[model samples]
Target: MKIYDIPGFPNPLRIRIVLAEKQLASQVEFVKVDLPAAEHKQAAFLKINPTGTVPVLELDDGTRIAECTAITEYLDNLDGDPILTGKTARDKGVIHMMQKRAESELIDPVGIYFHHATAGLGDALREYKHPQWTARAEWGKLQGEKAVAGMRYFDSVLEAQPYVAGDAFSMADITVWAGLLFAHFARIDVPDDCNALRAWKERVDGRASVVNPA
Candidate 1:
């Protein structure tokens, strides 16, 4: 299998963590996609993923899987036991719910703020960007505000529980972690009162699966 992604980017980091957790890092070859050069939008890369997104997984036989969640689902189930995603129907439901919330409320907003509000990857990538950049930039700032609210919400959730989806370290937690990471990249500040979320991040950041990827 081959993984196409831009190193250090949030979405790719999610998959790298999953690969480390699943102990499958050795089984796959990572192919770097140059985002700064706008390689993803080029025809050669678009043929693999029309969406022009990174962290795409190509199976040995040439089947390509895009999107973080879909790729995660495939890798998690490849083993006899699933960890990050959950094993039971209820677990799946809750984890998926929380994961989507993390993306919609936090990660996506941070990404919007970074790309639309700020000069993202410079002029070479402008053609691949959304039209009406000025208006979108104003809108992106609002989304950054929403992401701040999301931080408070997740902080409250962490105050009552150890992890995002209850006691276990799941993909929901990973999404939030990646969101915070994106926040750092985008210059979004975490609420000073959100102590629980800050501490949770410290714990998650220490995991061997995260600290030292296979």
Candidate 2:
């Protein structure tokens, strides 16, 4: 299997964390997709993911999977233990719910702010951006605000629990961590009052799975 992604990008980083957690790093080859060079928009690359996104997984048999959530689902379910996503029906439902919330409330909004309000990946990716990006400065700023709100929401979540989805580290935690990382790149700081969230990140950062990715 091959994982095609640009290193350090938030979405790719999410899957990288998943690979580390699942201990599947050695099972797959990593293929670098040079986003700055606009390689993702090229016809050959688009053949794999018409949406032109990174963090795509291509199986040895030529099966292709895209989207960080879907890729994480595949990786998490590859074995019987099911650590990241969940182990039981209720756990699965809650983890999936929180994961989607993390994406919708935090990750996606920050991405919108980066691609629309900011200069994005410079002129190289301009042709590939959505047409609405041209006139969405105000909307993108709103998204930035929404990202902050999302952070506060998660801060409250952490205040009550050790992790995003109850006691165990799961995909929801990965999504929020990725969102915070993207927030850092986009100059959106976590609020000073959100100490719970800040401490949660500190714990997540110290994990071997995150610090020493294969």
The 0-to-1 C-alpha lDDT of every candidate, in the order given, reads 0.92, 0.92
Error of 1 at 53 (Å): 0.8
- The global Cα lDDT (0 to 1) of model 2 is 0.92
| Candidate 1 local lDDT, 1-214, one digit each (tens) | 9999987999999999999989999999999999989999999999999999898999999999999999999999997699989989999998999999999999989988888888877888877888987798899899999999999999999999999988899988888999999999999999999999999999999989889764
TM-score of 1: 0.97
Residue-level lDDT of model 2, residues 1-214, one tens digit each, is 9999988999999999999898999998999999988999999999999998999999989999999889998998888778998888999999999999999999999999998899888899876776775468888899999999999999999999999999999999989999999999999999999999999999999988779765
Query: Which residue window of length 10 is worst by lDDT in model 2?
Result: 126-135
The TM-score values for the models, in the order shown, are: 0.97, 0.96
Model 1: worst 10 consecutive residues (lDDT sum): 120-129
